[model samples]
Target: MLKRLLLLLCLTGHVFAKEPPDVECLVVHLKYVHCSWNKQGTPEVNYTFYGWFVIIRDSADVSECPSYLSENNINTGCNQPCGSRFNSFYTRLVHENQSSKEKEHELKTKVKLNPPTNLTVHYGSDSNLWLSWTQISSNCVESEVRYRINNRNWAVVSIGKQNYCLNLPSHSSLYELQVRSRIGYACGLSEFWSDWTEPVVWGSNNSTDPNKMNSSMSVWTPVLSVVGAFILIVLVMMLLHNERWVICDSQTSHTCCSFLKDWFKFPEGLKEGLNYNERPCPVREYCHVRQSDSESSDCSTCSVTTDQTDCSVFIPVNESDLPTPCSSSISQF
Candidate 1:
């Protein structure tokens, strides 16, 4: 009898020694369960995966999983019509001896969900939130909510306590909202949880409220516009002020140019006060001719002023229209 018991122990040890298939399982939004084994690296017919099936046990369901590995060897599973979220489900694979080798996997540990999408926040009259978002993964799962006020530390709210996170405290102060998810108590392992979603803010408080910004920016907008216009004007003036001055060529200066200049020059009036006439060069064209003996002239020069009685004129000639030549013919005085 002792030998028989020893033989049973040996058989049990051998069964345990045989390596299990590498089984991984996930659900498609509760549409179906998919379990794959030893996807590609193994040398078995199905990439070292022998015909096998997944086994799952959790708080919600406890049984050898009905899901089958696909013939393609990559994927297989049973229909899970409930489309449920799973939490803390233990999973492993079973295959024929000498077919494949693998270890156990938790649904939560195996499947990593993307962050929730399209998070939005709206405050209701009762201070409740009209918050909503679509889960990133098609598979159904449970989620938790977190919130903060004015850049403070984050605070958590139980998803079970609040339906779809609707029981937030109503406040006028700004509030930041965020969410993270994990496999639920459904058919999957719930050991893993996704990273937090991007945050959303909502509020009507004027002071320190992100949504209610100060009006100082609006006031400064016109001032900035004026300054910009002034700068533009100054730039345009500077560009136009750079004038190219061409020297008036000296070669072109002539009588005509001088005449134009003189014509345009302001006239200073002629010399005033006591006027005395004097010819600049009085002796224009003449040589002194001696008076003829019979003429009895006092001087050789022809006289112009007739009223110099003391030195009476021998012959008067208009100085304005003077004679061309003195006549040499003799005449009696």
Candidate 2:
């Protein structure tokens, strides 16, 4: 009887001395099972995880984890192919000569999905800001969006669709947005929500109204163009005037006056009762020729001159030479 009593005490002591590590299991993306454990009171000792998934209402043979996740060359987690959703997970931790007690976990509510990716923001013509992202499982997940204006407090809203729109957004304020997702009820219930995605930003903090700036630009563009054309025309006119001044400075004063008068004077030849000569009245002509090949031993010859003609003569005119007009009455006195 004393031996039996000692055996009973030994068994009770062994059971009380053993402490199992805390284990956790999760279904990732509804495709695989991941189980991990932490050393509860055995920090110095490393633990290796092993798990088996069995249907809740069915019996199945045991299978080992396909891949083991390790830390510091010690097995710390187990990865197994996911079975039915209505299943229970059995996990154990082992360390060489010692092993932990088996633990059970229900996996129906333990699903966790990856975070949404490629978050995008767009401002539409209807004064609305649209936010959207690419989801891993498009129809099987729901999302929640949180946004803040100009680094202020965040506003969160739940959405079933992949996109959300904010109507009549403020143009002067900046908008910062993020989204997170979880499994929907139609697919399966998940107790965990995905981590929030990287933030997307739109709009600005400037206080100036964009519409007013655009209107001002439209108004000033045409005015600036007209002003530029007028300046160009004035510059061309000034250049032409300077060129005329240069031409006048290179000639005699009489020629310069004639040059200026020609621009404004009408043709005298087109007048009615003028008896002026068609050709110049007192033109002088002089002609001379010399032998180009004359030598020093040969006698030099004088050039022949033409005699002066009547057309070449100059006559002075006085007031007495002018013709007198007929009198209305032949000296009535």
Candidate 3:
């Protein structure tokens, strides 16, 4: 009886002598997992005796008992009990795997952008529209942005540095512009589009009636040309009229008279009186003779004798050579 009791006490002592399983510390590194054993036993005994472990599973939630076991051998004293050992290790493994999966999911997810602000549109001289806006954030860069005009095709633009400008087509049609920014690789995340910029309508001033300007220009051109031609004709006529009456007053009147006399032939009598060679004839009815004071005339056919000369014969003389004549007349036979 004493031997049996002693054997039972030794068996109980041996069973309880195994140290309790510890909670494992699983460390996550950049690309790998590092796990350490933390047990209630002495450091020297625990360090080399327990092996680090890991388990990969698909499911997010599962009971701790059925999941998996450590590939490394851990000496849990000589008894090697099963249930008490696995709880801490299993909990930590499940937690570490969940954490790693969550981190990977987050990395794969894309970023997003806020809506654009202070949007404006302007018309350029080339009949094109220019669209501009302020940056949504400071992290915008590269060809990560794209746009659409009026829900048409998407046009990519470089957003590596922020800010964007869009050139619109040449037309007066109203357009609805939509802009989106890429948040992650391959446009993983995008932003809500901005409202249309007042529906910019483009076209020429006379787009509705294109022919009106051409007609107006044509009419005015002919009218102006006719007016100019008329003015030129009038100026030429005036110049010609003035040239016809141009006379030099500084010339003598005698020269004018002489020119007129040469231009037109006069009657024979008028020509004879103006000629220098014609002698005065006494028989002519309209003839006059002049005598000098120092001279005397002697006539036999008529009873006329005086200091003045009788009109028996006449000679042509200049008016300067004539003396003062006495008042008398002779009767015709």
TM-scores, each model vs. reference: 0.32, 0.55, 0.23
Residue range 23-130, candidate 1, lDDT tens digits: 556644334445555454442443222222233442234344454445555434333332333333334444443433334433433555666787777767765776
Off by over 4 Å in 2: 1-9, 12-16, 39-43, 56-58, 97-99, 207-333
Q: Residue 179 error for model 2, in Å?
A: 0.2
Which window of 10 residues has the lowest lDDT sum in candidate 1? 270-279
Off by over 4 Å in 3: 1-105, 125-128, 142-168, 184-333
On residues 222-287, what C-alpha lDDT tens digit does candidate 2 reach at each position?
999988866765665477477765343322544654644464342353222112223323333322
Q: How far off is residue 141 in model 1, in Å?
A: 4.1
Best by TM-score: 2
List of clashing residue pairs for candidate 3: 141-159, 141-160, 142-159, 142-160, 172-202
CA lDDT, candidate 1, residue 232: 69
Best by lDDT: 2
What C-alpha lDDT, on a 0 to 100 scale, does residue 267 get in candidate 3? 40
What is the full ranking by lDDT, best candidate first?
A: 2, 1, 3
lDDT of each: 0.51, 0.69, 0.40
Candidate 3 local lDDT, 1-333, one digit each (tens): 999999999989857654334433321211222233334543333222222222344423323232122324432222111221122223322221332111111211222234444555667776566655554444532223454443457566555544444455646333444343334334333332323233333344443354875787888999998888667656644663587533322234345434534644434554443333322223322223345423453322223433322446555667776633433344332
Give each prediction's root-mean-square deviation over alpha carbons.
22.5, 20.9, 28.1
